[model samples]
Target: MVVKSEFEKLGLPTISVELGEVELEKEITENQKETLLKNLQDLGFDLLDDKKSKTIEKIKNLIVDLVHHKNSELKINLSDYLASNLNQDYNTLSNLFSEIENTTIEKYFISQKIEKVKELLIYNELSLSEIADLLNYSNVAHLSNQFKKITGFTPTSFKQSKDKTRIQIENL
Candidate 1:
């Protein structure tokens, strides 16, 4: 809504606006682009102009959405899901993501999942088994192993400890 309002305030006709993307009725002028960029920056949003950067951001957004928003388990593999959504080959997407982000897509996805696990642990509303099931892990053991590998804290230990540390999704 903020993005849409910004465009409307600038007298730009937008066909649609979604997270990380916007479709305008027509091309925006250089001045309009500059104004939009400035406005978005003021709102803590960066306008990604490069195709590679945009694609990378899209990938990150999709993974974040999948882990944080969707309640159902992923029926297909991550690569297939990403390729189908982005209309690009998995290898190409993986290569581009790795080159730019200095991390594999799998690693990034795991990091997001770990962040979600941290959040769930902090909430203390679900058991480890429930969290594993909710996150589509094979079992509590698997979740515990991965959680320990990434965070150096077993889920139980993290939950029991005085300080519970969680990283921001964007920082991952």
Candidate 2:
């Protein structure tokens, strides 16, 4: 929404907006493209003009949303969800993501999940069991195992650590 607002602020007559793509009422010139990029950058956003980069960003955004924003566990597998959402094949998407990120899509998704667990753990409002349930973990042990694997700290230890800071979403 804020990204779309930025486009409208530029008086370009925004047409549509999505995770990796944006459309304007008319085509843009080189200078206009530069200006738009600059504007988005100023707001900590980027205008991806390439398919690969855009697809990567789209994947990241979707994972972030699923892990952080969604209220329930996904009914479909991640591969199916991503392919259906992006209208791309799972194998192609997985290959591209792995090649560019040097990490599998599953690993990136797990990282996102770990980050969310860190946030929930730090808040202290929810019990570990509650947090596990909220994040759709099958069990606290499973969540704790994955959390320890990623962060080298169990959920309890993470909460106890002085440096409980989380990675920024853009960094992920």
Candidate 3:
């Protein structure tokens, strides 16, 4: 809504405005682009013009949505899901993501899942077993193992501890 309002204030017709994306009814002048860029920057957003950067951002957005918002297990492999969603080959996406992010897509996905686990743990609304089930882990053991590996603290330990550190989704 903020983005849409910004464009509307400038009298620009927009077809759609979504997280990390916007569709304009028509092209604007370079001056308009500059003004929009400045406005977005002031609002803590950056205009991504580079193809590779946009692809990376899309990958992050999809994974974040899946882990944070979706409530079911992924029916397909992550590679297949990403490829199908982005309309690109799996290998290309993987290679590009690794090159740009300095981490494999699998690692990033795991990190995101771990973050979600942290959030659920902090809420104290679900048991470890339930969390494992909710996150589509094979079992509690697997979730604990991955959580320990990434965070150095088991879920139970983290939950019981005074300090629980959760990385921001964008930082992850």
Candidate 4:
């Protein structure tokens, strides 16, 4: 009842609402759902449908998985891998991602990789060369160049800076 009332206040036409202890399920027709989503977007909120949001979430998970499990020795090409796994063409995914996120997927991927590099650097467990190898960079030089370009500091300098900060993965 409360949920339905709230939807009504938003000028939304609710079909049904189910309240659960841990989750809420709202059954809305496609047109009504799209209308509500458009309203949210007009209010400066992103309205990603289940399919689109799930695709983005899967991409995020894949990045994390590659970082944690693959350690940057990612064998599969990103476009081919994403397309095959998500059952969508890379171009479509890329376009949708850019339209929604306001950034290219490749940039997001690079940012995540740089974050992992920061993590490894903070641990002080691996040499720069080793870190490069672990992250699948061609060499320390390439990693240093990319790191400097992304963070505006050399890897060594970044490691030494007392206030080096990295954005959280989820926040990115």
lDDT for each of the candidates? Answer: 0.92, 0.86, 0.91, 0.76
Model 3 poorest ten-residue lDDT run = 68-77
Tell me, by lDDT, which candidate is best: 1
Per-residue lDDT of model 2, residues 1-172, tens digit only: 9888877877778778876678789988898889889989998888888889989988988888888887574544899889988999999999999998899999999898888888988888999998888877789999999999988998998899899989997887
lDDT of 3 by residue, 71-152 (tens): 5745458898899999999999999999999999999999999999999999999999999999889899999999999999
Query: Candidate 4 — which pairs collide?
Result: none
Ranking of predictions according to lDDT: 1, 3, 2, 4
The C-alpha TM-scores of every prediction are 0.94, 0.90, 0.94, 0.70
TM-score of 3: 0.94
Q: Which is superior by TM-score, 2 or 4?
A: 2
Better candidate number, 1 or 3, judged by lDDT: 1
RMSD of each: 1.2, 1.8, 1.3, 7.2
Model 4, runs deviating above 4 Å: 1-49
The C-alpha local distance difference test score for the whole of candidate 2 amounts to: 0.86
In model 3, where do residues sit more than 4 Å from their true spots?
none
Quote model 1's TM-score. Answer: 0.94
lDDT of 3 at 116: 93
Per-residue lDDT tens digits of candidate 4, residues 1-172?
6545546865665455542111224556777667756765665444444677767767776766776568744656878877887788999999988887899888888888899899999999999998888888888999999999999999999999998798887788
